[model samples]
Target: MTNFSHRRVKTGSDPRRLADYAALRNELAKLSHPARPDVNWQSVEKRCDALFEQNGVELQSAAWYTLARTHLAGLSGLNEGLSLLETLITHQWDALWPQPVAVRMEILCSLSQRMQQLLRTFSPSDSDYSALNLAEQQLTRLISALQRRELTPLSPLNALLSLIHHSAVRLEKSNSAAAPVVENDPEVVLTSTGISAAPSPETTRSANEVKWIYLVPPEPQLATNPQIPPPAAATLWQPFALGMLAMLVLGSVALWSWSLFQRPDPLQTPLASSLSALPSVLSPMQLETLRQQGPLSDALFTATQQQLTRLSQLPPDWATDYSRQLVKQAQLLWPEKSRQLTQQWQQQVNAAALPADTMNGWHQGMTELQTLADKLNALDEKRGRYLTVSELKSAVFSMMTHFRQTIPVEEQLRLIRQLPDDSPARQQQIEQAGQHLRAQAYALMKEKEKETTAASF
Candidate 1:
């Protein structure tokens, strides 16, 4: 939506190219929904291939393509999904510092989700269980990789791993209850097919042998410290030392006097100059309050304008990071602003003074605001928040349902699209608000149906 053509730049194999790769990944994700029969897979593939050509097939591109392919293949119920996941897992392990650990974690989560989906479609006895088992193993390895790399494990990844472990346990329990017992020779190696069982003596021996080789004790080495003789103290050097000490003391006094005279006067420095700069650190409550204000309010609008002005004056590196923080803060404030706008519109609707077109514009604006708020809330959830994305999305969807009960879709779209793009925050708000409207439109349809039934009765 942000016109990738204007943003695109030809660059060599550098980490900065990851931005382009992420853009492609997002586009592919939008087109990869399984239930959307309207999506053209051939066109999606062609677009993806064109990106691959533009960037060249590097490890990062391979990762992006494999993830995109996994999603597409998964939708079609092709075994290629599982194969692509396996390839990704292998690539993650084999490559030297493959992609960012976060990207790897996402791939692992995707694989886990695909495997879980597959398990639902196939019978317990189907070989697809093996794929699930492999996915579980890969997740275990991914957890180890996170630990080994000393990276903090993402909350979602941990949740997914816990889920997979629980599912595997449940599957094992169910399989064991239905499985027939088959005793084998004591010497014969017995391995678990799908259910957990006692290992045979041969299997135990093999495992212990590997551990024994790696865990062997090493001989302790003696500890020693190097000793250097101190230099001899001589009266012959005393005269030089005394002269140097005298010079040092005199120089120190002179330097201190000069510094005192040269220091800037604290009273002359304006307090406004210091206060104009953004604080280096904000407290959590302060951050929350800043995030809850509506962008339409004069206070917030002026503050954001000032912040943007300050941002431009900052160094390039500082500006980049600060801009991201500003965007996130703006996003968080959207929901509260949306709710406020809705209330204002409702009051105007009862007044009967506003024209029909004016009332419609208010409704459209509120709808767009609420939609963007939901997405921002979803992004916040990804930052390890307690509220789940599903819950927030559901609530926003309910609000949209209420909106649609009063306004038509075509009018809403037109009004929302016509929203002023005077600032980056306004532009982003308009774009994300329109992007997910249709998906959330029916989220609360069943609830509406229930209410209708009750009312009719």
Candidate 2:
């Protein structure tokens, strides 16, 4: 290999030059460009030609010719640099081919600097970064070429392996370095196939000459962590540092995942469990307020009135033990008011007198009487288990349904205002029921759309 760090000699043939062209050439030689080992020359030439045409420059000058040649030479250096960058990307530095030790050191130093620059808003996709990498590679190759003949340094990759061997020899000097001093003995031939009956010292020595090649550590030989690199104390902590970072990131993710899996679902909590421990007893004002609550008060008032009206309609002997219990409970809740409401409803039913020839009014009054009777009957069945106002509220709320359908919006609002608000549980149940009804309606609408599509098909 020859050093290309000297100037082009000028033979004083061109006197028009202001300075010695040789001196300028010498400086230019020092400004060497790196070689790219794997760049495609055909493609580069085409690109260069296009650039020259675009730039409106003559390609006849010596400078232009040199520049073109330099550009082509840069391909090798560009390739080498790209390989390093690729190694960083893939993290397979140990797997790279043997490189000169100094070259490797220079590469590492240059890469460290380059990485710092790249870390400025480091975008892997940046075209500028790639171009800079190519430029650096070209520069490194140029320097290496200038110093190529100065005792070719050992490959950095090989040097690293040599270092390992050296370290091993240093540690186990006696056992590894001390060669066995063999006394030659007479050799005997076993067969014509070079098998010795009595081993010659030379044959044994040759047989013992082991050649070792390094391979990636096997799974069992490695620590439990797959990401961790093999321990190295002397070299830069690059591989180990990378491994530790990877392990840390993985560990954090695992911890986060475990926490998520261990966490309890909010929906799984028992329904209304928080509110179960409230005091059952209320002050007089609290009780009064509770009675005025829309749903609770409405259920109690309407259920009581209906029961009393049914009692008026039926003979005392005809009423069951269940009905009697409901009547008693209603009376305890509202004695005078229940009586008054029952009287008013009975008067309304009775006043609708129908002609003996027609059963219209009679049928209508009997229907109302039957509805009231059924409500009282249900109350009789449920009183023991149903302490909350929610149980009775539905019955009273249903009575307002017919009125709501027939009345104006203002009247409907007034009717709704009569509902009780004493029980949160009852309110939630009612809201859920309404939502279910709405969902069903939407489902039916969807079904209709599907049917329409089927018909078209």
Candidate 3:
């Protein structure tokens, strides 16, 4: 029974040694790989030569290099040499593996001490920051080398590495714990097998297989039914809509240009008279368009302003009568109820008129129109009687007749000043106004009386 137990123990022990041997051989192959570009042979050789010459250890070039660094790290009172030892340990793990456990432990202890020592040497201005980074990289490599050789799987060495790793974890935990709680929700749960519930089927694929798994969903396949033709692709109607919008824009531009340039004949009596009279309450754009179309009309309107005076000068009944006459004329020329009447008038003028006579008449009509326009404007500006309800009807008709015409100021101003000042309530303010019909009438009456006295003399 004793012999069997001993045999069992030996069997268990044998495989562990074999495992160590196999792992070490693999690590050696990795360290010695020709393609392993990280290992620097010359610097390592130089370091080993210096150490071996001092220590009197006889070894081959590579073996001496490996053993020399391992000794430098394992020795006491060599604090500055730790960096050199760290580099050697990373590149020469194969050599270290053949050493006894005591030696390996001593080397690891030295490495850990060296790591702590390096933290103090961290200078922001140091050109050797890359070397330091390389040093850290080597430390990582050494730890991995140990693992490859089953060194980290052992109790004491494993515990030491774990202690270092855990310290880093604790430091990170302390910092994160100091932060205020940002998330009210817990982390997403994973399955028992470490998969998230919504784990991508492709996530488990090997690196080489990853390319085959598209992040985007695949296009859907059509049904295999023979009877149905494939549904027609949705037609893009954008071109048609754009074409229609373009046509509308062009039409509007053409209309605007025609209206702006078109002029009226001034010789035609009713048309000329209508053109002569315009309201003060026209919008600036509208007024500008009309002025461009018929410059003669504007001149006539100005002359009329110089002639006519305030409505208050007229008999109260006469003011109403004049308003009715103007309204009736406006309806005949530019009727609001029927646009056809205005169109018919235009057609008649086109049919009967000679081009030169029409042109000459238009010029004269525009001049008279401008005169009357100025008079109407002066009346409209005053605070006294000017337009009544009947006159407003007349003005609307005039605006429609001269659709090409614009109010002489801002559109908002024309709207605001639509009601004329010759109203009864506004009579008190009539004297403040200049060039009104009443004022003109009073002057005329005084002149007539003076003429009678002269004749008597």
Each model's C-alpha lDDT? 0.47, 0.40, 0.41
Write down the lDDT that model 1 would get: 0.47
Where's the lowest-lDDT run of ten residues in candidate 2?
4-13
lDDT value, residue 406 of candidate 1: 54
What's the lDDT for candidate 2?
Answer: 0.40
Taking the candidates one at a time, how many backbone clashes does each contain? 0, 21, 40
Which tens-of-lDDT digit does each residue in 1-457 have in candidate 2?
Answer: 2221211111111221323333333333433436424434334333333332232111111222223233443322223223223222122234332234454445444333432332333222322233333334333443354345343332532333343334334434434444433322223222322212121121111332211111222233444666867786776688888999999999999999999999877844543353246345569999899768745647867987997797688632232223334445556768976786556644532343222333243344456557766767887888664335685565456545533334333543454556677767656645544443444443455579899999999
Model 3: per-residue Cα lDDT over 269-387, one tens digit each: 66566447545766999879977885565777777776466543657335324443555676776677546655665454334323333224434545656765786788877868575
How many Å off is the CA of 173 in candidate 2? 70
Q: Which stretch of 10 consecutive residues in model 1 shows the poorest summed lDDT?
A: 208-217
- Would you list the rank order by lDDT, best first? 1, 3, 2
Error of 2 at 60 (Å): 99
Off by over 4 Å in 2: 1-416
TM-score of 1: 0.26
Q: Which candidate wins on TM-score?
A: 1
